[model samples]
Target: MRLLLLFFTVVLGADESFITPQEYAAQLYHNPRGIGCHLCHGEHGEGKVIAHYIDKGEKKAFEGPPIRALDFRRFDAALNRRNTGMPKYFLTAPERKALYRYLHPETVKDAHAEK
Candidate 1:
């Protein structure tokens, strides 16, 4: 089991050398390990209206809030907080930073795109 784990880790780490952080984050955000952020947040973290319904006999809209513009601290806090309307990902710090980079590529330092 340990040998298999080591082999997989080595293979994945090798692939990482060619892929940019943004690519990794894009895959995570779109496919996650489970529920996709894109389903709620849209392709660019711009957020989307999920559904329209009647509440208290009044029409209401359920929408995902915009995330791209949030500062890193606020973004991290939101991701870490429990009871978020979204599911808990329990993402690692680097993963969170990568997601932030995917959302705001212009603000981030150089993220080399894999050729």
Candidate 2:
């Protein structure tokens, strides 16, 4: 059994494309470019509190917008344009689509599926 597996491995030549579409999407979501979407958006893109502090003798909070419910058009526009708070990312069309799909898994079941 070991010899057979080794033979297949050698024939396939050290394949690293074993990650599933969901796994790849997760990786891209977590480490696309330099920052992870989860840093601001919640793990499931449900939004999150980025920071809390005091200003003008009062308390304030900086929050990341929830994006799980966004439509593809809005999502694409948000990523492509120069937003006020968001860091501009030069992701490809497919990449942006992938991220959007990642943000909304239910509606996009197999829509952007790629290995």
Candidate 3:
């Protein structure tokens, strides 16, 4: 009886370190490489106005566009390409997919299910 209890406890303890896909995606979204997407994009990727400035006294708002609504193709493409102010992280395919999943939870499916 004691051995059975010990075995179950060990199994449960091992399971604690294994994070779900959503949790992994959240980590990638928040801190991929050294820069966090949330710095410019909003906490949930809803976009944000990073700064306000006077460009030749014109008054300009430097903003991060909402990314939560972008489809996977567009999202992947944007990350791969160079934008005017956006940093080039050159993330891998899996990293990009994870980020997309984090933004669009509704579309998330079991990764293994696709195979």
Best by lDDT: 3
**Candidate 3 weakest lDDT stretch, 10 residues:** 106-115
Off by over 4 Å in 3: 1-16, 109-115
- lDDT score, candidate 3, position 109: 69
Q: Estimate each model's TM-score.
A: 0.78, 0.78, 0.79
How displaced is residue 99 in candidate 3, in Å? 0.3
Candidate 3, residues 27-106: lDDT per residue as tens digits?
98888986799999999999999999999879999999999988789999999898888888978899898888888888
Candidate 3 positional error at 9, Å: 15
> What does candidate 3 score on TM?
0.79
Q: Candidate 1: worst 10 consecutive residues by lDDT? A: 106-115
Backbone clashes in each candidate structure, one number apiece? 0, 0, 0
User: Candidate 2 — worst ten consecutive residues by lDDT sum?
Assistant: 106-115
Residue 37, model 3: Cα distance from true site in angstroms: 0.6
Ranking by lDDT: 3, 1, 2
